[model samples]
Target: MALGKVKELVSSNPVVIFSNKFCPYCVCVKQLFVLKLGVQYKAIELDQESDGSEIQSALAEWTGQHTLPNVFVGGYHIGDCDSKFDLTP
Candidate 1:
């Protein structure tokens, strides 16, 4: 179920970020995409959602990444902040 939801979100959005509100890395990733790159993205703040843990678990299983700020671009997993920075610009 959570995996299905993750797939739907990734397919629907040009960019999707699974984040935690208080994580500095999440904040940085969002700012880089939304502010620096001027790209629009759907940010799912796990700490604020009821099914956040399940969603995160699904994300981990799907991406093999167990970290906040899990990013996807154009339906492709873009990985963490460093990965994003390396790919961008």
Candidate 2:
């Protein structure tokens, strides 16, 4: 299932971002990782993918929350843009 894939991504990568490219909040999260933290992350832009909605839905089911820029770090669901910013070093 798509949710399984979402979990796999979260577990496998140090940082994972499930986002929508057009969303400013999503953009902010990406910038935080790439610009501020200078870390490479796996950014899955749902808006750009054909099965994005399904993936987003699956992410919600798995993580118990739904929003743009769902962020996972070190296999932990760290939450959205603001949460990601909080984790920035």
Candidate 3:
């Protein structure tokens, strides 16, 4: 189910942010995309979902990295928050 949700998010949104509401890094990542880059994005708050852990597990399996703010842009895996900074000036 989590995998399905992940796929749906990736396929539907140009920018998908799988985040935890309480996470600082997650908040930062969202700001980078929405505020700095001016790209409209979809953010799924994993911490609010009952199957958030399951989704995180599936993301780890899919991306081979278990970190919050798992970001995907244009259906491409864009790594974590640190990687996002690397894309910026």
Candidate 4:
């Protein structure tokens, strides 16, 4: 179910960020996309969700990444904070 939800979100949004509100890395990623690049994105605050744990677990299974700021772009998993920065100039 959680995997299905993740898939639905990834497919529907051009950019999706699975994040935690308090994580600094998550904040950085959000700022880089929304502020630095001025790109619109859907941010799913996992810590604020009722099934946050389940969603995180599903994200790990799907992406092989067990970290905050899991990012997706145009239906492709873009990895974590460091990975996102690596793609940027």
Question: Which candidate leads in lDDT?
Answer: 4
Best by TM-score: 4
Task: Write candidate 1's Cα lDDT for 7-58 as tens digits.
Answer: 9999999999999998999999899987899999999999999999999999
Lowest lDDT sum, 10 consecutive residues, model 2, at: 80-89
> What is the clash count for each candidate, in the order shown?
0, 0, 0, 0
- After the best TM-score superposition of candidate 3, give how far the Cα of residue 62 lies from its true spot, in angstroms: 0.6
Tell me the whole-model lDDT of each prediction, alpha carbons only.
0.92, 0.87, 0.88, 0.93
On the 0 to 100 scale, the lDDT of residue 71 in model 3 is 91
Quote the lDDT for 45 in model 1.
Answer: 97
Error of 4 at 34 (Å): 0.9
Candidate 4 lowest-lDDT run of ten: 80-89
> What is the lDDT ranking, best to worst?
4, 1, 3, 2
> How close is every model to the real structure, measured as TM-score?
0.91, 0.88, 0.88, 0.92
Candidate 3, residue 75: how far the Cα is off, in Å? 0.4
Residue lDDT tens for model 4, 1-89: 99999999999999999999999999999999988999999999999999999999999999999998999988888899666334442
Better of 1 and 4 by TM-score: 4
Q: Is candidate 3 or candidate 4 better by TM-score?
A: 4
Candidate 1 clashes between residue pairs 3 or more apart in a chain or in different chains: none
Clashing pairs in 3: none
